[model samples]
Target chain A: MEPKVKSAMQMKIQVRKKKTIVAKDRLFSFLFILPSILAIAIFVYGFIGWTGYVSLSNWNSQIPDFSFAGLKNYVSLFHDFRFQADLRNTAVFMILFIVLVLGMGLMIAVFLDQKIKFENLFRNIFFFPMALSFIVTGVVWQWILNPSTGVNLLMKKVGIEPMWYTSVKVIPGVEWGKIQVGIPIAVIAVVIAAVWQMTGFSVAMYLAGLRAIPDEVREAARMDGATEFQIFRKIIFPLLLPITISVIIIMAHISLKIFDLIYAMTGPGANFVTDVPGVYMFETTFRGNYYASGAAIAIIMLLSVAIFIVPYLLSNRKGES
Target chain B: MKKKWFAFLSFMLALSLLLVGCNSDRASKSGGNGTRLDIFSWWTGAGEEDGLKALIKLFKEKHPEVKVENAAVAGGAGTNAKAVLASRMQGNDPPATFQVHGGAELNDGWVAAGKMKPLNELYKEEGWNDKFPKELIDLVSKDGNIYSVPVNIHRGNVLWYNKRIFKDNGLKAPKTFAEFFKVADQLKAKGITPLALGDKEPWTATQLFEDVLLGTLGPDDYKKLWTKEVSFDDPKVKEAVKTFKKMLGYINKDHSSRNWQDASQLVGKGEAAMNIMGDWAKGYFVNDLKLKVNKDFGWVTTPGTQHSFMVITDTFGLPKGIKNEDDVMKFLSLLGSVEGQDTFNPLKGSIPARIDADPSKYDAYGRLTMKEFKKARITPSLAHGSAAPEGVVTKVNNAVNIFVTQQNEAQFIDALKTAASELK
Candidate 1:
């Protein structure tokens, strides 16, 4: 009976020691996170808060006086023809960019997985563009896409005599005539550049997803006399759903905040053709309309990303569950 | 475990103290230096760099104790520099001295906020009114107070042409719009593009529009149109637009995407006939590219204009919260002085702000511009000068760009009307 009581007392002492160790672990974890928290609070949160405040006031160039005109900036933004145009351009770019990047990415990944020659070389070739800065890629793309100086001249040398880059013609009877347009050309150039840069990233992710599938699953399908195409369509594609959704969400976020490529390729003048919400925000702030309207636009862009991402992430979580 | 926690806390406290010390040191260095002045500008390239260095050298020689640090933001039209400057100023960390054109755009926000110090006292002390050109003095002053120092007078109405091309065609410099068209026709007949135009930059198009307005419509009408006194639909304004559109026929087919320097090179290489750009193009010709002034190229104002020269000037403004007030005063005094203006302007490919400078020291074109200055043929360019406000200028630029590229006269008129109405 005394031995039994001593054993219980020993167990109680052990339990108390474990609790102290757990508390110590928790304290270390908190300490580890403190610096990151401070950094985010000071740099990220502070800038965001400052931008929000600036967006409430009309701060023009060289002038520092900003008056709180409350919602007047928003009213003006609604009426701003350029801002509306930019929204339309950004929407079109986002939709088209996502479709192209994902579609191309999956196809390339699948082709590489088929035991092609120079597999590593091909993968590296596709991924090399991703490593370049957007500014450098933009400049290269601009040189390639410039109608007068680039592809047009190359085509001329090849005896193709390309006329499409210079002039725009619509069906005469369709309430439109031949009107010269560069905006569409500019947008296409931006998309091509973006896809070139991002397809490698998508390919890498898709490859990982493909590799995660167990060999037994494929062998079992083969044993069932399922064709390769049938196996890929029915089994492999379905498993990639999560990865595909994640890629779409991430690419969408990237497309929304795309500024450097567009800015470098074409200056503010591109606002006529390829202005996105990001570029518009820049112009607005630079033009000294730095108050409610700028903030409103930023908020609008944030809400848009949230609207798309929240549902996607929720579904992803549910899929995991 | 307690000792570990105590050590971690102490380390964190030390780190925080270290950060605080570093930040305070930075703040003091940037904001508390009495002899140091930070000047931000968008000047780069060998020629411009040389010119700026010369000016800085002179400034330092005059004020031995002061140290001038140049924050050069190199981009054409200063769009990048403007963005950086806006962000910095918004963060309440403006540079000591910054470049701003002498116009409403330069004075827009800072002047309204009372963030710009009036240079009126400096102007009086330096006797700037007696030395500087009256037109330039008027250009830099707002509400009877000088806020910026006019550095160099840029003639924006100069029409530069390859002298060889003109001579080969047996055509003299056109003195009237009618004569200019005839010359254009002659060049076209000879299978040459009459105008070597670069319209990729909208400002280039705007410059063309301003030149046409000043040359065809005269200064009063141009000012009235720019200031929104007259609607764009007015028959005279429409006439000006029509004339400009007609001139567009003389440009190359690929003029839509060429750079201004490349366009100038077209003339330099004798590929195209002429280029109507600002006098700064002279720098590209005579200074950098080694084309002789009045020999390889010729510079003239657009024909039959009441005002022979449309002048714009580069100016600088001191931001509020300037660290060294005495240094700011010294800088302002130096900027307005005859010696400073003369030394800086010639290197900048612009005429001096002070009319009292010796013309013998200037280039042929500069001397000619100085002569125009003497004859009172100087008028402010609406494109670069102080005719319209900033928002209005941007709107007009967009409208003109659309007009040129879209070739939609009605849309152009509507856009202009909208822009004009916004001014009020």
Candidate 2:
């Protein structure tokens, strides 16, 4: 009976010790992460707050002190024709760019996954454009896209006479009034540059996903008399759904914040048909009017990125669970 | 183990705090000295750098104890530099002295907020009124108080032509609008671009517009149009726009994306007949491109313009919380002095703000402009001058850019009217 009572006491002591150990572990974990938390709170939060405040004021080149203008800046921004045009341009860019980049990236990845010659070499060649800075790439593309200087000249050499080379106006009765678009040359220049830079990143991600497919699974499909096209359509493509989704989210984020390529190619002025939301914010802030409007634009862009990405991330989390 | 981790975190926090403290202390000490003057300007390139270095040397020689820190942020046309300045000023960390064009845009907010220090006392003490021209003094002053020191006067209405090209083509410089068209036609017939123009920068387009307005509608209409005294849709204004549209045919085919300097190069190489640019282009020709003015190039004011030359001047503004009031006074005094103007302006490729300087000491173009000044032929450019504010200028720039590129006259006129209505 005494031995039995001693064993129960010993078991109780062990349980208490285990609880203390876990408490210590928790303390250590909190201490280790404290610095990062503090940094985010101060720098990130502080900057965001400062940006919000500046946007609400009547700030200009000469005005040092900014007074609160409330919704006046936002009102003016809405009234600004340039801002509206930029918003429209950004929307069009986001939709078209995402669709093209994703479609191209997938096709390249699939082609590369096949037992092709110089597989690694081909991968490097496709990815190499990503390494160059957007500013340099934008400049090169601008030269190439210039009607007087670039493709048109090459076309002329080939005896192809395109009317866009000399004419500034769209030819009437052209499909949807599209023939004489002056600014599209610059816009096309930006998209081509962006695609050239971004496609490599997508290719890399898609390649990783493609490589993760099991060799045995393909052998099993073959044993079942599945054709190459049928197997890929039914199996491998479905498996790459997550990677595709991730690419879409990332590309969407990039397209929304695209400023440098557009700005470098065409400066923030009237000739700028490729003006994105970021460039518009810059112009508004520089001109020192309706900073609140600039802030509103920034917040709108942020919300847009979040609206798309949050759902994607949440679904990803659910899938993991 | 947990105690150790807690101690480690505290140590890290302390270390970070110490590092931050050290940095802040260093920054404060650097800025504490009254002798340290943070000077900001948009001077870049080899020629501008050399000119600025010369000016700095003069400044240091006069005040050996005072330290002048150059905060030069160079970009094309001062765009990037101005944006940086605006951001800094908004953050309430303005430089001690910064460069601003003498105009209403410079005065709009700072002067309204009482953030700029008036240089009136310095002007009186230095006898600036007697040294500088009355018109220049008026340009820099607001409500009888001088807020800036006019450093140099740049003539913005000059029409530059390649002398070799003109001579080869048997074309004399145009003295009237009618003759200008004839010269343009002759140049075009000779397989040459009639005008070395880049319309990508709307301000370059505005240069031609202003010159035409000065030639066609004269000075009064120019002022009325800019100051919102007359609507942009007025028949007289339309006439000016139409004349500009006619002149558009003279521009090169590749003008849409060409930089102003590249346009200047076209004329420099005699690929084009003429360029309507400011006298500052002379600096590029002589200093950088190794072309001689009046020998290889010729400059004239647009014809039939009644001797009116568009003049813009750069000046220095003292920020509100300047550290060394005495040093500031000394600097402002020196900036206004005849000796200072003579030393600074010639290097800048501009004439001294002080009219007392001898014209014989200046370059050929300077001497001619000095002669024009003597004849009272100067009229302020509304675009470059203080007639319109910043917002209006940007709007006008946008409208003009679209007009030049698309050639949509009705839309251009409407945009101008809308922009003009916004000026306060």
Candidate 3:
């Protein structure tokens, strides 16, 4: 063979090998992710599909009866008093929990943003509750908020009698169809406990956001003769909106599926006031063996969760675009 | 080459995690063929736990070849334990035996699910049919097949009172509705809570309500109500609701915050006059809280129901798919035996389910209870699951919880009528 021809053959082989390397890299990444996608499809999506099917059936008895009853479980849920109470509780809890957590978190982050002494110590102290499980926080708060023995003891000294978590629905209940809708007084105590534990997460996020805001922007505003309040109101708060949305989405999801905390602290407080979907779903499934109703509840929770999370994902996609 | 190595590493890691998940499941299934006995119960409290340990020790001595695992879950009134059992059963890993309340809790919860192995053959062989009371036997049976062996019985309608408080106020144990109200009125005027009720669990209120039902409607009518021979909306049932509502008005203000034990404490401390709780409160009082029985506190059947015994029996059933059926049967036989019942019940602070339990082994309350169990017309309890199904109990609990706060008599009656449909 001619030397030029042999050299051309070797160069062609090397170029082909480089091209194959890129293809091989892409192939390997796909292979790695394929198992996860398949797993999620089978396990998560499969269970979800199964639950939806169950919800449309009359599987209330111990036996898993999957004969289609259609729209019945959902229709029953809409009229169901316990489910209505659960919805009312969840709405109130979500609003109260998010607002308080955000407010406390922002306040703490702003304080920490300042050149304060023992900043790390104070940060850790606030974040400490987040480190503990919701169950742990719930139990500790349960003892502390006990109407007779806990904070009420302190209140007793000041000639005040407070019911704490034991207090029934404070909001004068109005008939919402067959169900009575009201702000459960007991849920307020739960909100305070939930907020205390979760505020640290928001604090960390808000702190990062506050720190990420350039000092030059604030300085420029100051130089333009803007008051501190005006600078915060106009610049800092608006800049933190993205982070605020993230916090709201994350916290709302956590609040929706709240079971362990409520179960441990107070097992369905007076008239199911502290009752939420997670607890109701658990009890209906395990306690009553109402598989269909429980599935209906799970689907409702998933849909409600999507109401918050779907928009966030779409917004993230838009930001990237 | 390094990229290939990374790919291989990640692949192996994923495979290992998948293997790890599969392995634990296999480990549980593998034990099914082994000579292992796993006894599950929620008896993890002071006296209850000690009683369970003693029962295990006796079983150990009798069947030393069997490897025993005490799968007792510690929690309030077995609610958490039921959640654990549900998950375990769902995984198809049933224990050798697990504690169940005799009636609808076992039958409606597990038997209805086809999770329980019928124990009629065991009963025939062990002669438990003649050993246990027929009414009690009826509770453990569905369609003539005995499902479980009753270990001990806790009377739900027993009203415990502070002896000092009653004596201090010159009050006798109220035996009728009129007498109860008269005494309650006097106690109220003295600023003493007439009834110390801790309904934190809500079923505790249902317990009080069931007693009120028994008092309002006699034993036959009460039994008829559960069987659905009579409706829940019976005028007598209405009267029971009225009585229960009246009883609720006389209870402690902070009743919802405390459990049954805490209410017993209120009575023990002489702050409240009386508490209508199960006989287990006697265990909590004497064994845990360390108060003398019959001296610090005394008990009578919850008023107007002295002729009827409100029986709440703790039973153990053979769940399906357990390893060593023969070995498990030995445990069930022993559970029914006088020796097992006597050893377990004395420490448990409840009267043994077996009629032959030695009277000498029990306290004064147990002796009195044993006598009453034999003489009084036997009726099953609803809240603790001898009379009603879990579906019924769950609905009743939800309704009772709302009723405790709402105090709407019509709503409470309406709820009971709904729960009655669960039996059908």
Better candidate number, 2 or 3, judged by DockQ: 3
The number of clashing residue pairs in each candidate reads 7, 3, 0
User: What CAPRI grade goes to candidate 1?
Assistant: acceptable
Which residue window of length 10 is worst by lDDT in model 3 chain B? Answer: B26-35
Order of candidate numbers by TM-score, starting with the best: 3, 1, 2
Instruction: Give the distance in Å from residue A8's predicted Cα in candidate 1 to where it truly belongs.
Output: 2.8
| Model 1, CA-based lDDT | 0.74
**Poorest stretch of ten by lDDT in candidate 2 chain B:** B25-34
Q: Tell me how each candidate scores on DockQ against the true complex.
A: 0.32, 0.35, 0.55
| lDDT string, candidate 1, A1-321, tens digits | 999999999999999999998998898888878878887898988877766665677653344446775666667766665666566557767887899989999999988887889999999999999999889988888777665568877887888765433332321313212222223544666788889999999999898898899989999999999999999999999999889988999999988888898777754443255667787676555553444456767866777888888998787789799
Check candidate 2 and list the clashing pairs: A55-A291, A55-A292, A170-A180
As a whole number from 0 to 100, the lDDT of residue A99 in candidate 3 is 94
- State model 2's lDDT: 0.74
* lDDT score of residue A4 within candidate 1: 100
Docking class of 2: acceptable
Query: What lDDT is reached at residue B375 by model 3?
Result: 75
Off by over 4 Å in 1: A41-80, A158-183, A268-271, A288-292, A317-321, B1-3, B14-22, B30-33, B225-233, B421-424
Best by lDDT: 3
Q: Candidate 2's residue-wise lDDT over A1-321, tens digit each?
A: 999999999999999999998998797688678767787887878767776776677653343446886766667666665666566567767777888788888889888988799999999999999898887887887677655568877997998755332233322313222122223434555677788888888889998998999989989999999999988899888998888888889999998988887766655434445567897776555653435556777876777788888998898799899
Per-residue alpha-carbon lDDT of model 3 for A161-219, expressed as tens digits?
Answer: 88757877558778777556777788988898899999999999999999999999999
Encode model 2's per-residue lDDT on B23-108: one tens digit a residue. Answer: 78436734656447767888776655666677778888989988877888988767687778776776666777887778765666
